[model samples]
Target: MQSNPGSPHSDLTLAARPGAARQARRHVARVLPGWGMAGLADTAELLASELVTNAVRATAALVAAAPGEDRPPVVPPDRLGTIRLRLSRPGGRLRIEVWDADGRPPVPRAADADAEGGRGLLLVAALSAGWGWHPARDGGKVVWCEPAGP
Candidate 1:
């Protein structure tokens, strides 16, 4: 993890796996108060989880679909995916950016009351002032969102 001095910002790189979301929540919880942004912690953590979860899912899917010998080697040579989480409170808005190794952009599903999943982006939209994603020039994409009302 890397943090900027004199700023409420940090960059966390984690293995894109099943438990990454939980780790992200812990990091957010640890940083928010010191940044003087505790009020946004709950919602920020939720959004961070959703984004990281989606990223891990996408990376796992990609690895599973790749050819046996074409799969990218993970840090441990078996994990096969990576995610970078950037947390920043810039201009009075808490921005959560999750970068995954997959380039597919997330689409918000319809408001379905019966769906158990596929509602991550929907939750992000509802809880955030704005949300969107863009493909990274190097690879993959970055999904970002910010809390509502400062």
Candidate 2:
């Protein structure tokens, strides 16, 4: 991960674990304010959390479906692949991205009002200035969003 807060770009690689979402959120919380983008922090952190959570789940799902696994509650680090979070502010808009080994595009479903999950992408679209995904050069995909910034 890039350590220079002053730089326009920051990146973090995390194992595909349940905690990845929180770590990604914290990264946004730190980076945005460091870059003098505190106004974008709340939105960016939430968006980052959602994107990273999706990536972690997708990556873990792929691993669990592979041969010899009896569905462990939490994947061990040795068995877990990694997801990456890349943040940047270009042209004055904060962009958040999460990359994982799954190539499927994000599908936003019409979650029921009481549903505890499945609204990640919908929230991304509604709160962000723009959002999308693309095939990464090597493999998998990179899902990204830019929060509505002043």
Model 1 residue 95 distance off true place after TM-score fit, in angstroms? 0.5
The sequence of per-residue lDDT tens digits that candidate 1 reaches over residues 1-150 is 865445678989999888999999999888888787888888999999999999998887777774774543333334346899999877867899998876777877785688788989989999999999998766778899997854
Best of the candidates, lDDT: 2
Clashing pairs in 1: none
Residue 84 CA error for candidate 2 (Å)? 0.2
**TM-score per model over all chains:** 0.85, 0.88
* Candidate 1, run of 10 with poorest lDDT: 71-80
lDDT value, residue 56 of candidate 1: 92
Q: Quick one: best TM-score, which candidate?
A: 2
Superposed Cα RMSD, model 2: 4.4
Report each candidate's C-alpha RMSD, comma-separated, in the order given: 3.5, 4.4
Instruction: Give me the runs in candidate 2 sitting further than 4 Å from their true place.
Output: 66-80
Residue 116 CA displacement from its true place in model 2, Å: 0.6
* Per-residue C-alpha lDDT of model 2 across residues 1-150, encoded as one tens digit per residue: 884767889999998899999999888887887788898888888999999999998886877675675442333455359998999988978899898877777788899999999999999999999999998876778999999867
